[model samples]
Target: MKTLTIFTPAYNRAYCLGKCYESLLRQTNQEFIWLIIDDGSTDETGKLVDSWVKEQKIEIQYYYQENQGMHGAHNKAYQLIETDLNMCIDSDDYLADGAVEKIIHFWQKNGNKDVSGIIGLDADQHQRVIGTRMPAQIKRSTLFNLYNKYGVTGDKKLVYRTELTNKYPYPIFQDEKYVGLAFKYYKLDQEYEMLLLDEVLCHVEYLEDGSTHNMINQYRKNPKGFAFYRKELMKLPYAGQLFKFRQAIHFVSSSLMMRNQYFLKESPKKGLTLLAIPFGLLLYVYILFKSRTVKHV
Candidate 1:
């Protein structure tokens, strides 16, 4: 069995998938398998992957499912991964040099049943670290504390224990495709801390169609998914009042977008949701405006 499975949830990204495949080929260690969850891509993605499978340079597993946004693809990936450890490298991204070797060495030395997984850095194409680096002194921290308490920023690569990840499967809402991936990570935070690795594991490029760039559209198109994510965050016992309030505000806005008559009833923090109504109304208006602008462009 491989020590790690690098899964890519791709949707119509055939042009750039090659870069990710080539990066895997360059790995100093081939101890990981590449798992591609084809989330109903309509392009030449399937053909391209088939060619790679024929080359047989490394282990690859590919599965195709009806379109289900990023989080839905994640749900499928978690179901299929049998490796002891796993990590997600976006379709528009690739692994850094020696990344496989680094993950293997670090896990062998520090990995145990107690830790959820390893948290590593993600760099840009020019090798600049995204957001901020993990604090050097901290060896183990929950994903939430790494940001909320210690102030680590930017995009980071998470390599999770497959067993642990499977325990918190991301929920799939019908007709919605944009649940926050952190839903599962935050759940894991309740039980285990991840070991921090300062080395860069993945290099990312934010294509225009990528989720991060089109969040406003996501907000409008997937209000129920957003509402569910915010409600989950609000229920986190470790979350501070301010964080919960922020989630409440967004929850209210999404609920409104959904035209859900039970907004207040469904809220985890009804008092906070009531107080945030005005701000949420403003957010709803802004989403409408922004979505209109996107359509015009």
Candidate 2:
């Protein structure tokens, strides 16, 4: 079996996909397979991938599905991967030189029965670390504590044991509000602490229309985003009413920014939690004012 399976969920990224493909082809380590899940792009992505598959230069598996969003594409990757370990590189992302070789070697040397997989680093398109760091060693529970206390700070540049990643099919919460594939890593952390490699391997392009840039729209249009998170919050131990209150406020502001008046329109049902809005709004304003003051100063 291949040591690693790298998959990219792409949509209308024909321009960048070639760069990603070229990087994988040049990997010093040929111990990995590539699975490209086209997230229903209207572009010529299918044709490009078809050309690559026909050439068969490397082990590339491609699948086309209706656009169900990133979460849906990830769900498919989890199901289809058949390697010992799996990692995801975004469509607009590529790996660094010899990065895959280093990752495969690290996994072979350190990954074993006790460890689930390895966590690497994420960089910008120019190969700058985008902020993902974890301790060398940590118990699963402690990791969750860190996440709950400070929120998830790092890019989850994680590779998971294929078996573990497939345990929970991507959660398609109401209205498809799953937060990408976060719960997958969170759950794996429950059992195994991933081996950390303090090296940048993947470079993600922060395009204007990328998913990361659409937080406001997602919060506004996907009312279920709050509901899904509410469920996850309940699953955490120390997430109290205060925590939920803060989150509710954040969601409200994000919705308003996206021109989504869900909180106002659904006040009777969804706005019972509006009680937290006043404090939330005050905090938001304070932050904005502080930011402006700092700029002037």
> Using lDDT as the measure, which candidate wins?
1
TM-score of 1: 0.99
Write model 1 residue lDDT over 1-297, tens digit each, in one string: 889999999999999999999999999999999999999999999999999999999999999999999988999999999999999999999999999999999999999999999999999999999999989888899999999999999989999999988876777888888899999999999999999999999999999999988999999999999999999999999999999999999998999999997999988899999998999999999999999999899
Q: List the residue pairs that clash in candidate 1.
A: 131-154
lDDT of 2 by residue, 1-297 (tens): 788899999899998899899998888888889999998899999999999989888899999998777888998988899988888998878888798888888877777878777767787767667764554455233344445653546564777888887776665655554463565565656676566677788877877778776654554455455444434443444455666565667555544433455555543224435675676566446545655554475
* Deviation (Å) of 68 in candidate 2: 0.7
Please estimate how well model 1 matches the true structure, expressed as its whole-model Cα lDDT.
0.95
Model 2, residue 43: C-alpha shift (Å)? 1.2
Worst window of 10 by summed lDDT in candidate 1: 164-173
True-vs-predicted CA distance for residue 293, candidate 2, Å: 22
